[model samples]
Target: MLINVPENVVPDALRGFAAVHTDLTVDVERRVIVRRGAPYDGQVGLVSGGGSGHEPLHGGFVGRGMLTAACPGEVFTSPVPDQMVRAAAAVDSGAGVLFIVKNYTGDVLNFDMAAELAEDEGVQVAKVLVNDDVAVTDSLYTAGRRGTGATLFVEKLAGAAADEGAPLDRVAGIARRVNEASRSFGVALSACSTPAKGGPTFDLPEGELELGVGIHGEPGRERRAMMTSGEIADVSVDAVVDDLQPDAPVLLLVNGMGATPLLELYGFAAEVHRAMGARKVSVARTLVGNYVTSLDMAGASVTICQADEELLRLWDAPVSTPALRWGC
Candidate 1:
């Protein structure tokens, strides 16, 4: 809670973000972040957003090879239709814009409304919903599986396709394919506090953790006593593997839920790899870090994306974003 005022948290952070990332244009008033050289003519525009706490996500991923524009809402709150409409309008390059929406109820409704509004404004728009979390079928914030770590996979692959001047439909198709090919599961070590709350958002007694937790602190499968990193990986990896049943080599994401450090993340990643090997799952690529987060929650999530040759090629494409950058 190192903020001036609870209400000004997002805007305040945007100012700092704009100052640091010169390649991005942060419209604090409108609460939208767009790449400096947007509207790439024949390239399909990629737009995605969500609540504010998940840094380096919809915002930090905005760049030449990822999101073209992002509309950030208040922490843990969905952005309004106006924000989405503005983002779509800003990035549409006549090749049309694609909205990459998470599967939350509020996000689904608002982005849907924005797509229609953008179409009315003569901007062709397509959308893909990401519902990769395999933890639960329903959660407090969603009627179906919640979107989690695999969002990074969808955004990167789709953005690469868009950057290649893929048509709107093709880019949308890639995004949908990535979502369908991915699955994620999360476990929380502790609860996170918001600027407004000024304290832990949820209570977890000592020596306990939440399994299959949601990004916004939503309840998961069940609570259990603290376990070793390897044990946690065994269960998490099992959850996704059972559901995915991948037939090809996969891309793995060992994502931190904000407060977890890299030291622990890398170690946990080792265990994840071990678990994957035990299941006879082949891993083609691995990414580890706080790409997708949940405020200051101390936990991590595992995402697995079954990758065909084409999917792997798109993933290997150059991406220059604030959080994830490589092959540049």
Candidate 2:
């Protein structure tokens, strides 16, 4: 809404982002954001990307102990294969590169093509798909479950492995393991407006909410009247916990969908914790905030990853990224 022109939104934002994030090399022409000291010798490269509007996701996660490079697409649209090829090439060290792709049709297809292109260029590449959203078996944008909050978990844990000089196979293994262990569910309190549309993408009447909503404002499982934070948490947590059926302590991500205030998110988090307790699920680590977001969508999603000792350790490893950083 504050943008000068809808057409230049992505490029204009990239310019400002480049100016602010001096540690990253934001190639505006290529639309690839890579760490300054990329191709870290023997370390396997980590690359992930998706549509824009979800700030601090692929782009903001590009830094030490996280993504080596990220390719950003236009709002709610997948990046082309060229961007992925360039990102893989830019970050590929002697070790192979790992592509952490979300399970969207456009993303999967584009990343698949990019892997082939990168490999043809002598950059060995592997890929792991993130499909942790448990709301539906399939969605408008995906053949399978849509990738959601677990993307941050996969990027963080897998990035740590890569930072520790893990081989391409091992890094990919960690990513796959994380994905297999995670589940997410979202609720939408309001619809988001896109720059291109300049209006609400979907119609949501006042005092109603969409349960099990997708991040891109897609139709969800059901619509219901407005519920209290505790009631919403009960439903969201039940969805994830029932699907996950965790045997071990879990890593919890109570993520905001862009427009929700921290005040509401924290309160909702309290209810989520309570719900988990009621379900007899132990939470090992809790992260609450707007990590993965839908543009100005006032809602939240709950992501639960059953954490093993290794996963917890990798999570605790030092990370220095714009969006998520600790122990650095």
Candidate 3:
């Protein structure tokens, strides 16, 4: 069974979501919002997003130590310039705004236009495109890579630094560090429905799984026989840790794609913890749940953050927002 709606439905939902955060958001084009008053002088405003199905992502990450605004797109479509321009204006303080965009064609183009618009308005605009999906080969079709789970880690960590009053350059540097050290790979047990498509975006015949699937319905590296939760966790975490070789203590996240339940996520987290200890790697802390996701993709992704002293401190800092709030 498939369930897709009109393409514009997601935009409508975004508009309504923004209305609730009137003090923190604005649905100017009906799909975006700025989080607060103009960023403090010498403070950098952060912006991020991609498609809509991955809710509680870009938007949920808005607030202290997260994002200043989030521009959402239709189901899986990238948001256009109109949305980005409005968000940029609302958040631009004296310093500048950092666009934390995932590596996707429409997202890059639209955000680029917004940057031009902001620069014309005499605001400094810097952009960091995240492409941490190691599953995607560095090749044609895309502008080199794809951004996956790293988007969340970068947003929260970078926002943490910015909240500490770091300059745009320094905050951007921290974001880059997070990106360079993190990698993600996902698998889909079942396909998700798209509003525009009105049905399951992809199909998995019953027990087969697609490994390394992209968040936006792209085909993954390979499909394989199914395995238990612990084995799945072992394989995915191995891919991430092997790529990073993060000698320092690291932050571990075992995340549900969207439809996956917390019970499964907890089981996945336990396996991740066991595997890391076996590798002699230090776990600074662990965050488990659906922090970043693909519509209803029934899968999980693992992200490892090799944190330096400063970064760990930032991660520990308090953050208040619709999705994540702690250390209050």
TM-score of each: 0.98, 0.98, 0.94
Which digits, one per residue and each the tens of the lDDT, describe model 1 over residues 1-328?
6889899999999999999999999999999999987888899999999998999888999997889999999999999999999988889889999999998989999999999999999999998999998888545655988888888999999999988889999999999999999999999999989888888888988799999998996656789999999999999999999999998999999999999999999999999999999999999999999988989999999999999999999999999999989999
Q: List the residue pairs that clash in candidate 3.
A: 4-198, 5-195
- Of the two candidates 2 and 3, the one with more favorable lDDT, higher being better, is 2
| Best model number under lDDT | 2
Those runs of model 3 whose alpha carbons end farther than 4 Å from true positions after fitting are 1-5, 19-23, 140-142
What does candidate 3's lDDT look like per residue over 1-328, in tens digits? 2333475566566666766766565664557766766565667889886788887788888888789988887777888877777777777777788999898888888889888988888878889989887777655755666788888889989998888888889888889889998888787887777766666877677888888888876657788888888888778878887877888999777778898999988988888898888878899988888888877778888888898898789888999887888987
Poorest stretch of ten by lDDT in candidate 3 = 1-10
- Model 1 Cα shift for residue 119 (angstroms): 0.8
> Clashing residue pairs, candidate 1?
none
Query: Candidate 1: minimum summed lDDT over ten consecutive residues — where?
Result: 135-144
Task: Name model 2 segments beyond 4 Å from true.
Answer: 138-142
Clash number for model 3? Answer: 2
Off by over 4 Å in 1: 138-142
Compose the digit string of candidate 2's lDDT tens values, residues 35-126: 99898999999999999989889899999899999999999998999999999988988799999999989999999999999999999999
TM-score of 3: 0.94
